[model samples]
Target chain A: MPLVDIQLIEGVFTEAQKKGMIEKVTDAMVEIEGEAMRGVTWVRVQEFRSGAWGIGGKGLTTEDVRALTS
Target chain B: MPLVDIQLIEGVFTEAQKKGMIEKVTDAMVEIEGEAMRGVTWVRVQEFRSGAWGIGGKGLTTEDVRALTS
Candidate 1:
């Protein structure tokens, strides 16, 4: 079973986007693991609260992530 | 940076339990990656909605998970 975990800042993505991410991640894993393993592939999105996810000793907020996209 | 993602069935764990899991997971990674990298270590817990998690092509519900513990 291939399990893919995607982490994002909370409020950054909508439910539909998360669903799409799960589908695409599963497909990506199946490409390597084979179609038979599709049913066992699990993709879950986990969100970190603002100021909880740290990088280089800096806590990132949702606005910080949004700024990166722009 | 070491990222540890833990997937659990929703509603099965309390907030304190999850926090403990995060701490333990981070410690486990630090043991391998060293103390200097601890700041970059990320341990996240993602929960699947009841009946959304599947194993062997069978969807698992929260009740199914609780039953396993009992």
Candidate 2:
């Protein structure tokens, strides 16, 4: 019901953590994207190494990013 | 944060439609699963034939399911 296709970058978050992340991400998208909450959905989650997908090019595993203070 | 790995099977829906699904799914997970909305997310949307996924095993494409009544 949400975007048919989507790719997400997530890290370190445990199963519970991931669940929470999805909830919030969806809420934000609905608020910001002006989409119906019922229409929201989960697509895909991609794990990345620190330097692999973010700015600053720091070497951080998905776990590292999740644990990052800032 | 939220669960990091999740596999989702979704039926027919547009980009906006998918987005809405994510938002709602996340919210539901939060309410029922007691996870944070932020942790919920879009994982993977696998297009299934009517019979490919869901009950009755009816041969329905993703669209058929999305448009399904009830």
In Å, residue A32's CA in model 2 sits off its true spot by 5.2
List residue ranges in candidate 1 displaced over 4 A.
Answer: A1-7, A12-70
lDDT tens digits, residue span A1-70, model 2? 3332323344444566545545565664455335443364444444544455544655546655444423
Candidate 1 deviates by what RMSD?
A: 7.7
Chain B of candidate 1 achieves a TM-score of: 0.92
Worst 10 residues of 1 chain B by lDDT: B15-24
**CAPRI band of model 1?**
incorrect
| Fraction of the reference Cα-Cα interface contacts (below 8 Å) that each candidate reproduces | 0.12, 0.00
Worst 10 residues of 1 chain A by lDDT: A51-60
DockQ of each: 0.13, 0.07
Tens digit per residue, CA lDDT, model 2, B1-70: 2332222334444566555545554564445334433443433334433455444655445555445323
Error of 1 at A60 (Å): 8.5
